[model samples]
Target chain A: MTTPPPHRPVPQPTQRVVVTSPRTRAPRARRPYSGTREINEQSELGAVYMRTLIRAQRRLGLSVCLVTTGVLALLPLLFSLEPALGRFRVFGLGLPWFLLCVATFPMLLLAGWFYVRQAERSEREFAELVERP
Target chain B: MTSGYAVVAVLVVVLGTILVGAYGLRVSRTTSDFYVASRTVSPWWNASAIGGEYLSAASFVGIAGLIFAYGPDMLWFPVGYTAGYLVLLTMVAAPLRRSGAYTLPDFAEARFRSRAVRGVASVLALAIGWLYLLPQLEGAGLTLNTVTGAPDWVGALIVMVVVTVNVMSGGMRSITFVQAFQYWLKLTAITVPIVFLVVVWQVHGAESLTAPEYPAFRQDTEVTFNNDTMIHAERSLAIRGTGEVDGVRVDGGFVLTDGYHRIGQGSEFTFPKDATVPHLSTMAHNTNESWALPESSGADFPLYGAYSLIIATFLGTMGLPHVIVRFYTNPNGTAARRTTLILLGLLSVFYLMPPVYGALGRLYTPELLMTGQTDAVVLVLPARVVDGIGGELLGALVAGGAFAAFLSTSSGLVVSLAGVLSQDVLRLGGVRGFRISAVLAGVVPLAMTFVSTGMPVADMVGLAFAVAASSLCPLLMLGIWSSRTTTVGAIAGMLAGGVPALTAGLVTMFTDTGDAWYEVLLSRPAAWTVPLGFTVMYVVSLLTQRHVPPGVQRTMVKLHAPENLGLDGSGPGSGDERS
Candidate 1:
């Protein structure tokens, strides 16, 4: 085998350093910074990035959806399995009414809030990775 | 009801919409502005606009009516409707925005590189748009007839003309602001009335509204049948009124036996307090408890129907042409996702108000059950519950809100339908072509309003959702996620899913059927059709792997990639990297 090429160390900038030179290093060619943009330019990189993002999103989405749909589906089953459940009331509102009408909104909102927070977090992580040298 | 106040309210909304459109026209100088407001709509504003357009007469008037007629089970309508956005936000919103296509058909053509797929998508969009539009027109007619006693067609005609004019004048730019404004207006109109009505209910002594008995008129009530009505009396009904009953002219004090009785057009029936309210013959055949209990409502296959409705509304929202088009207004994928998040809140708040109206309607406006015009319960409740000028004012507010709902949603649908019609079918371009398409879009649905009768507004909207869910939901999901989706597979999936759903929708719309399994199957096709669509697409795509679009890899990257990445996301194989 031929001799291997030498590895070059990546330049690491220190936070404390403040270079005030007017035109140091020819402005560094204005490289694209966004991770998404980097992936967009490189098809192989893009494929990996997309797979990760989609997988995370789909996993989170499916979990939330399954939970929500489970509750909704179980409601009728609960009623059928235990007829007395329908008669069960909280604050004079029937259990089904209270659950389906009044309670469902907050639950759905919470689910949405959870989803948005998680999704944005995933994006932020991806963005940070893309920004790293 | 005071026709003058209601008419004034309606005129204010119509004129306001027109003025807004004219203003948008003045500002919209570029084609980009007309198509997507230069893709600069903020999340909150776009969310509100989406909420405005999404909460059509179905949500505004029909949900309340359904709850009143069918009880607690109908609560699913609002729940399903609101949750639909959650589904959209999770699965489709970001990718769809990143696709950067102006319409659903555009997305299809871009994804599959198949004009045939685009053609089918265009037809489905038009069909779904029109199907959705029919209800807004019908609701307008119903509202006008109830509030002003105008002939049914006049209200539909007015709405059609106004929507067409607005769309032709300014396209989507004007509609964005108008719809966003209308969302707040609608929320206030609905919420304010409910606050007063609920206070009134409490002050009048909040009696147990959940007594397990059929509804009884709380006070003396007069019901006018605008069209011929068949009422099923559980007990003999003694009425003092004038007009024709069962083809006999009764001056006063007519008795309807415990059976079906026909009340002719213009017939008026006055019922005494505490009398059991007669049920509409159309709906009375089913067993429903007075308290609108969940399982006791005697819906045929309630579980199946409920699950199907959930499937349709949840999966179906992303496929609505008007709704999907709004996603294109977002500046980027992030904004699109943010808009959906905000929309969930807006829609949840708005949905909360309708159930209050529905519950109050059941308490105070039981006579609607007899007229089978339960959908008008939301309009009539404010006047019935509140007293004097305040009542009239609240009634007018509700009227204004209802008109706004009709106008905003119908206008959105018309804009979307016109856009597709102009681009695909008419093969026309520019503003003038859009104008002609606008007229075509509005007139056909307006004509449908006259031909169809007796179908509840929400049910009609549901059929539209089913069709959308069956066809476009599969197309959108698979197109974005799966690179192996071939053009043949896409076409096959759409036909397998859409045709059956469409046929079912058409059959349900045009024909009346007894309580049969086939009828239920046709009426609620989403449960099966959606699955059928996915299965066909998946299996066919697997079999025809060789025919997969050559550029799907790049397209997938563009769709899932962040907009900041600067990939060429315009279409497949056009990967011009923007620095």
Candidate 2:
């Protein structure tokens, strides 16, 4: 058998070290993020930059998710405040009610939809970048 | 209900899961493979595994029982459970996958760079995992006892033995296979019996018997909680079967009656019109009124506490140790994200079936709730709806699924606990330590099942959510994305959040005093404890932000950056961007 593509000197076998080096190169990635201009460059390096941009955009989506969920979680704290809107009065059970009926679930559903959209958008861009090669 | 075939079917399912795991032993050569399946599991497989682990015995039996006992209100459990994934998808799915950590504790150590925080997290993880496992073991014991008339311990022991072997032999790889298989088992178990039962009900021309036809069917039941206190339960309860009321022959006829009991402030009970039943004693709270469902039944409280619990489950999905660890088996974050979406669909399909059981429980067995047989509503459902061999077969199928649910969830929890215990608690640094920790993790809960027997399964699960939400949730949320996280803050927050929950949970669990403080602490602790934990972490983190280590920037980059950016120095630029 031909010498199996001379095992690229894998400097260290420790999982942590292997994962860290590429992490340091992350900042260099920001250099080519001039929106569509970077995409048009069509160079391999340009593809890499676009990939990085797609990733940053995805990270942006994640941040939005955090903010939304953070706010949503805090929704209950708002209701605990006295004199909210609406009440839960089914079968003579007079309970003070608010957004949970019309708002909480619907808001959650909306948030989920927005998140799926962002994730899908990022996935499509990444796929385009991958196809460039 | 006894069938040799039923016993064989259960054996086949259990043996099958263990055998699958045993078969995976060869692939688990490395420590990484043992813990996370070497980061190569596909989205479908991972989702299946998640679904398998997710459909626990509680979902199988307890929820239907809860619905049977509590009317339509119990439907919230399945809804909340399925919805929790949406929260996870938006907030945590990809970031957690990219964290490149093995367990939740690993995420804390990486994020806060604190061995102390890691230590505390490990302790909390172990505690929660152990706490969660006790119910699973108890459920197993209850299940086997119900199915075969076997001793309760035998069920716990059988599951314990199979799970230990499965976990030790293959780690996540074997578990992935076993769990996926279990999802189908759980689904089939739930669906087949339901369909068969519906067919049987149809044959009996159940349509002739409307809600108005039952003898004790009342237009309204005025539930007066005290000698003078009164609340009207406006909805009618259709009492099934034939009975003589006021010495009159009545087979499927109607009436309205008053059933009530006095309960102190912040107290909850189930009052029975007929005495000797448990849940009929309505849990009366002397009126902050928030403690009891508002005069609106459950229409109060924005979303019901049941829904709040669901929201926590959905958003809290990412915080779960067992659920998150499954993502590590994927090759990258994209796969992990996709796996989460698939999990949503799987969870949705599976959830559709619980309500049917719950609805049927309402029609066939109304007394289950009153007698604490609410837990058995799903278990005995087949016999109630259908007769003979078909019922026995369906029961066997459900038994197998319930067992599968127990094994998958228990093993996943055990694995997560084992990882944390070895890495942080015992500080057992290698592969050998992991295996030992795995076995030790399961043993504690197995032991606990023998000591504790009366705790309600649903309530115990709620306590687990509260503990997890209070402790790990705040820590995980702040640790990632927040540049201000510090070791001292994480440690302090965990203690503040975790200790009160642990104490309240223990008090609520071990004793039946039904004290007001217990209700405040156990039922609504999240409102106070969660804020306390966050406040401590936030304040401490802000104070310590100035002293952040030079490596903090680098770690953040690793966390936030893309996958393919080779960490090599080949990128045509500069220096190590150190502080």
CA RMSD of all predictions: 8.4, 9.2
- Scored against the native two-chain complex, candidate 2 gets a DockQ of 0.11
Instruction: For residues B365-386, write the lDDT of model 2, one tens digit per residue.
Output: 5444333445766776786577
Cα shift from native, residue B136, model 1 (Å): 0.4
Task: Quote model 1's TM-score.
Answer: 0.92
lDDT of 2 by residue, A40-113 (tens): 33345544654474356557656765665566445444444433322345433323222222234455555666
C-alpha displacement of A113 in model 1, angstroms?
A: 1.8
Give the per-residue lDDT digits (tens) of candidate 1, residues B311-410: 8998899899999999988877778888998999999899988877777777789888888888999999998899988998899999999999999999
Residue B287 accuracy (lDDT) in model 2: 17
Show where candidate 1 strays beyond 4 Å.
A1-30, A33-46, B284-290, B569-577
Fnat (0 to 1) per candidate: 0.31, 0.07
Q: B257 in model 2: Cα distance from truth in Å?
A: 15
Kindly give the stretch of ten consecutive residues in candidate 1 chain B with the minimal lDDT sum.
B570-579
